[model samples]
Target: MNHDGLRFGNLDYMQIAWSEVTPGEVHASWSGHLTACGESVIKAKPVYDSRVRDITCAECGATAVFDLGTAREKAKAITEKYEATGSLSRADAVSLRETALQTIAPQAFKARRAGDSWNAISSNYLMSTGAATETDGTSILVGRVGLAVIEGLEVSEYQGGY
Candidate 1:
């Protein structure tokens, strides 16, 4: 049962199926809980070259489409921002994260300082440090700030387990 390079192993977290009767048309189905806060039962038929399609979540009444290129671009931009700033305000962090959620599913970003609380979340994945090496190539005090992307998003929720 070849499925046009689609495999359940790629989406072990959800129940998924597909029928490839025609050469370029594939009908796919998926049902499972998302990593964020919703249940999903999605059906979609996309031609081989299709770039966008919608999926409605049964648990949260949320309807969204998956755009892989856009999501990757957004993620890259967000990552570059963090790499440049090395730190972010709470509002900026949250806003960037929300923007990521618009194109992707169940994404989390986190930033923290050495002595600060870790209660905020973002949508981009990045990490940085303030530590700088001495001119003599000696180790110095470590940096206090850090950033990271926590991966729990259910790509299968939108990809029909692709």
Candidate 2:
């Protein structure tokens, strides 16, 4: 464990890595960085560090992730595509995570209302609900973002209104 009490190989830690294999992505990123490799998810594995300051991959000499369209737009298009063709983009599953939470459980939706003690509540909820990340909030790694669009909210906005 380093100064922050984090160690390599911590699933709860998003490991900073050089993109030796691909572009616009990182290795073992699950340390809860919302914008990781444009994937929006980090798989829990061995790596180093946990502080947010080191979250940027530019430090590793890799191209940073491009924050494309908003989640709502992507969800809409994703659902339409699935409806017409029945195909899914597993690579884009991270986009559906928050929207799905808003669709399914509006009460705990962090985008709208995150009360005090959110970490405790979110951690407990994530573990029990089989959420993808160990971090707080409803950052679920949908793994198949299209499924949530087709099945869950039908690509509707979760927070305020569509």
Candidate number with greatest lDDT: 2
Per-residue lDDT of candidate 2, residues 63-104 (tens digit): 111111233345565445544554534444333544443433
Model 1: lDDT equals 0.29
Best by TM-score: 1
Model 1 Cα displacement at 9 (Å)?
15
Indicate the residue-level lDDT of 45 in model 1: 34
TM-score for all models, in order of appearance: 0.24, 0.22
Candidate 1 C-alpha lDDT tens digits along 57-85: 21111122233333334444554565467
List clashing residue pairs in candidate 1: 97-123, 109-122, 131-143
| Local distance difference test, each candidate | 0.29, 0.35
- Flag regions of model 1 displaced more than 4 Å: 1-29, 32-37, 40-64, 68-72, 89-95, 98-100, 103-162
